[model samples]
Target: MAMDADLVTAGVLVIGDEILSGRTKDKNVGFIADYLTQLGIDLKEVRIVADDTDAIVEAVNAMRACWTYLFTTGGIGPTHDDITADSVATAFGVRIDHDPRAVDILTRHYQAGELNEARMRMARVPFGADLIENKVSSAPGFRLENVHVMAGVPSVMQAMMDAIAPTLRTNSALLSETIDTGVGEGLVAEPLRIAQERHPEVVMGSYPYLRDGLFATKLVLRSREQDKLKAACEDIETMLADLKGQRQAQI
Candidate 1:
């Protein structure tokens, strides 16, 4: 398969009480999805679990085993509910210890006042885990086996994603283009399917958006190769143009 044709998959484990209780909307999924999609990594599944050790461990193990890479967000901070590091260690049967590198990263940039025992808890990592660099904040995330543990905050999560994304294998990004058609999806379904068959590698879809009183449709064509995507888009545009002409003639 072409580098662009292969699929690289990942899974996300979101651990928190706020998310499960509906207090937090869990913004990490869309952020990570967009980021990884840009890098050609597909996010296959996402699991949200409360702050429970067994649940965290099971989810960590399961996702790591299933996906090419696994990521966990939340429950790694300084607070009492933070137990991700310990749970991850338990899942991998490793010991969790305070990593000097993490402590050093925190020590250099963060206020010494904030480096108290509670905050120092952030330095802990599973034995043999590799630290993931964080540019936005000094405190680093870490990786054990295929699982990459990251912070929950959107800003910090993005930083960690930037740090780790380059290290993973990625297929070529699926190039996509959209065209606005002031027509309903129902009218274009058959032609769209024909276009899809013409370019078997490209995935095409129509989205209907109701704005004000006008119902408009957007035809989206996506493929890993730029040429294929462009060709598919051109074909879709032509079909839509034909449909418009037919409608005008009918009136």
Candidate 2:
């Protein structure tokens, strides 16, 4: 299907063997999703890959081509396993070397003897890439085309996101309304399906949960168009009201 030109979309790539091995719990994906959503950018997909160069390279190329923007986290550190910058360089077929700007930042942040070879690895970036500032740490992230590579630390990644947010292209913010149906999903499924069919533009979903030891559902409707979302929500309310009446009659 052809995507709406007005809709801006993004993809997230999380890199690290620690994450894959369950050694590190990821916190950046949800943060980035919320951040992008507020800016009217839809986060369409997320991929978690190990710290392997081939895997990172493949994910970078695939996601960057598929979405308007691709945000990556992890593997851009001083350690030997920190290979995100190099992998991204390979993906773009660009030369990887110490970016003078990044090196300068690290030099300023660290002491005379602290900026060793291991630490210098953080300065390496793909050719022709713009630096993404890291307020938490001196080691900066880089923006190579549409792909943004940032540190794995939550605080640092967030800072990079803030640095890059202003420059991003955004679309209309998605509007959403949630209705507590006060009933089970099974009872509301057919009605929700009908409402979805009637208002094809609105995205409708029913989330089932336990309330007071009984089944309950929350129906959420979302759309970029306010009028359509409001209309669809009203129709859903009416359907739920009718369903309630029918249940009472049966009782």
Candidate 3:
């Protein structure tokens, strides 16, 4: 599908058997989402897959083609299960080998005896990929075209994101406003619907919560345009005030 030219979009792929098995709880997805949102890149989708090669390859190919950037976390470590580098190389039909730059980084970080074969696995990068510096650990992540492969460790992944953020393309930040309607969603559904119809440019959602043992709704409106969001918010407030007045008269 053709993406909107005005918006920068992204997809996240979380790869690891441990995450799927619930052994490791995910912390990177939320962090990445908030990070992208702040940079005006809409995170359109997120998928979690195991260490399996086919699944990784498929997800990498699909997400990279559809979004402006695809960020994958996990499976880049120095173990048998760390197959992300190979899978991504296969997906892009590129050769995989130990990158001299990555090897040098790992070499400098580790002592002479510590840079074993297993540790060297971290240096295997897809051809023509630029290394993403990991400030926490020297085992660098890589950027191949639009795909960014980073370590699953939260701190390292966050550091990698910081390293890449400055190089990314961004759009206008998404703006949002919320209103506490002080009534149940059922009571204000029609008015909210009318408001949405009147302002088709704004996206609206109703979140119902319990307040003082009674149901109350929080209506959220989001838009890229500031003026449109403000206008829609004002309209909703006016409509809600009229509804409140009618309810008071009935009581």
Model 2, residue 188: C-alpha shift (Å): 1.0
Q: Runs in model 3 with CA error above 4 Å?
A: 1-3
Question: What are the per-residue Cα lDDT tens digits for candidate 1 across 1-251?
Answer: 12333478899999999999999988999888888888888788999999999999889888887888998999889998999999999999989889988888889977758689888999998999999988887788999878999999989998998889778998776688888877777888888889988898887778999978877788887777898888888888898889889899999
Cα RMSD (angstroms) for every candidate in the order listed: 3.0, 1.1, 1.7
Task: Give Cα-based local distance difference scores for all models.
Answer: 0.87, 0.93, 0.95
lDDT of 2 by residue, 1-251 (tens): 24787678999999999998998999999999999989999899999999899999999999999999999999999999999999999999999999999899999999889999999999999999999998998799999999999999999999899999999999887899999999998999999989988899898888999988999999988898999999999999999999999999999
Clashing pairs in 1: none
Model 2 CA deviation exceeding 4 Å by range: none
lDDT for position 84 in model 3: 98
Total clashing residue pairs per candidate? 0, 0, 0
Which candidate do you rate higher for TM-score, 2 or 3? 2
Writing each residue's lDDT as its tens digit, candidate 3 over 130-244 gives 9999999989999999999999999999999999999999988789999999999999899999998999888899999999899999999989899999999999999999999
Best by TM-score: 2
Which candidate ranks first by lDDT, i.e. highest? 3
Provide the TM-score for each candidate, comma-separated.
0.85, 0.97, 0.96
